[model samples]
Target: TLNKKLIEKSEELKQLSNDLSSANENLIIKDRQKDDFLDSVAHELRTPITAIRSAGEILADDDDIPLDIKREFLNNIITESDRLSEIINDILYLDKLQHGEIALNIHENNIIETYKKALSPILHLIQQKNIHISEVDLLNQYIFEYDEARMIQLFHNILGNALKFTDEQGTIQTKLSEKNDFLIIKVFNTGKNIPEEDLEMIFDKFYQSKNQNIIKPIGSGLGLAISKRLVEAHSGNIKAENSGLGVTFTITLPKKIINNNEVEQ
Candidate 1:
């Protein structure tokens, strides 16, 4: 009886040892992932900082430079500084949202109006690209309870990406439809499609598509990641697909109607 009890105890100890080993392995993997994320953030910050510093130095040291050239350098410094601030703000906002520190102010709003608000901020870029937005399905009639600002950010990021990738004089199409209790929004741009492998990880943080043609110079590769988090926070889903003509991003949000005076979230 004593010998049998000792064997059982030894077996239990071996199982515990295996579990601890597995846990340690998992910790190692997560630690490496954290390190990689930090490294990317550092690089993103450093790029703009370096640009700003260089531009400032040129403006300060070149006393004999032409007035027009000096003005251009000053503009470059200001633009780079603004870019740096944007990156920092985005990173901080994402960190807060991930930690559940941000609260949603959900309300019933029209999707089309919100989309227009988002588009207004980037109209200059759109004009520069000579892109035409065609056939916007009337979404103003569809009312949904959600955080208006966050929804605008979501559409802004998606539309911005579409604008970045679509060729000059290309077309970007938006469509919205409701099926059962879900509202679906799709944005399609006519240009090079994303690589098949990237479609799977496109929403991942700091994940940049291997398709080089669409990568813009100023992107920190965090916009889609932030957009995905914001959508999920509102009990919705977002996805991307590579169509024959280009890429399409789709968002689905749940809809519920209660009494005439109220809407369920």
Candidate 2:
């Protein structure tokens, strides 16, 4: 009689365990569905935005329109389109990165060359803001093996962040140096110091410093998170530090010097 009772209890416990497992699985599925919904919404909105921006540009090209008004309208349309495109690309790239499919095409590229290439598009803004840029004993000839596109994106994010946060006429400096066996890239910006508590989570997905006043515009808060992923993909490291009464981000990439001159220098 006791044996039969023990068997019945074991069966009941097993059924309960299975039910709990099923519940947990359902919750995971629901969470994934929510993420999917958000991604779909972003994609749908991007289509209409692209179409509208293109139409606006076409209209602006009409010679009948006043040149000044046409120019202003054209600029507004392009700016809005670029912003939307940036958001959509970030989301889609992040989604692929999560799925382990973002390809890295690493090559031996010159650091200064890469920096200059990435800065070309934003020179106007830097000039308008009166942000001063300098390097720290940086040699223009250092080369490191890395994914050019990904590193460019990383540079754009870090420098772009500085541009957004720093006030007009603030000084921003970038430095590249070789330390131990790694190549270090540092971007320093004078801005509101990030709270100590928030610093720990600044690289977390959807994490943004609450101390950053809504100046100009803010990104979707995924830039740092995506930057971290790209750095790690190259077996590199990245971190933030408070310096010069401001904020600085330090990135270290593992050095695979492709030239004899690299180690000699």
Candidate 3:
């Protein structure tokens, strides 16, 4: 009996030691990720800041520059300044999300309406691109519980990404359907397929795929990260898959995401 107890204790200690080692490894990984994020943020901000400063310096130091060329530099300054502001806003927003600083106002809403509402922000560009969006008829009667504002934002990121990579007159489609207890929303865009390795990292902060054959927009690259956080907040999952001739983002959400207080009601 004494030997058995001693062996048991020894096994427990070994397990504890393994757990500690695993945890230390995780901490090291987290530390490395923090350093990498800081570096990425600095580089993301510096590009725009440098352009703006250079344009400003040239405009300030030159009195005899051509009016047209001067106007071009001024436009460059404005564009870069806008890009800088976007990066900051996206970073702050992502931080709030990661820190659980944003609360979800979950409620019963029409999934169809929410998806359509998301397009309002980028409808002009979509129309200009002539991207065809199908499957609206399928979302007709599916009602689900979610945070409407956040859901709209989630859809916006997925759709905006689709638009960004899609060429003019390229196609975009949304396939909405029900399976078991979850509602799936898949946004498909016809364009260059994301590299296999990049498909997984597309949701990482400041990570953009190298293959952008159609368009090169000054994007903050935090949209998908924010979208992922928002989906997780609602107890859902979002994934990117290369399907057909383009890439598709599929989001699956449960039928209910009731708040604690609402649960009482």
Two-way TM-score contest, 1 vs 2, winner: 1
Off by over 4 Å in 2: 1-78, 212-216, 257-265
Q: If both were scored by lDDT, which would come out higher, candidate 2 or candidate 3?
A: 3
TM-score of 3: 0.90
lDDT of 3 by residue, 18-66 (tens): 9999999999999998998999899999999999999999999989999
| Per-prediction TM-score to the true structure, in the order listed | 0.87, 0.68, 0.90
State in Å the error of residue 192, model 2: 0.9
User: Residue 218 CA error for candidate 2 (Å)?
Assistant: 3.8
Clashes of each: 0, 0, 0
Q: Write the per-residue lDDT of candidate 1 for residues 1-265, one digit (tens) a residue.
A: 9999999999999999999999999999999979988988998889889988888888788789999998888898888888888888888888877777777777788878888899899988888988988756673488888888888999899998898789899988888999988899999999988888888788877776566665654776689888988888777789899878888999998774222221212
- Expressed as tens digits, the lDDT of each residue in 156-183 for candidate 2 is 8888888888888897899888888798
Give the local distance difference test score of model 2. Answer: 0.76
The whole-model C-alpha lDDT of candidate 3 against the native structure comes to 0.85
Q: Which residue pairs come into collision in candidate 3?
A: none
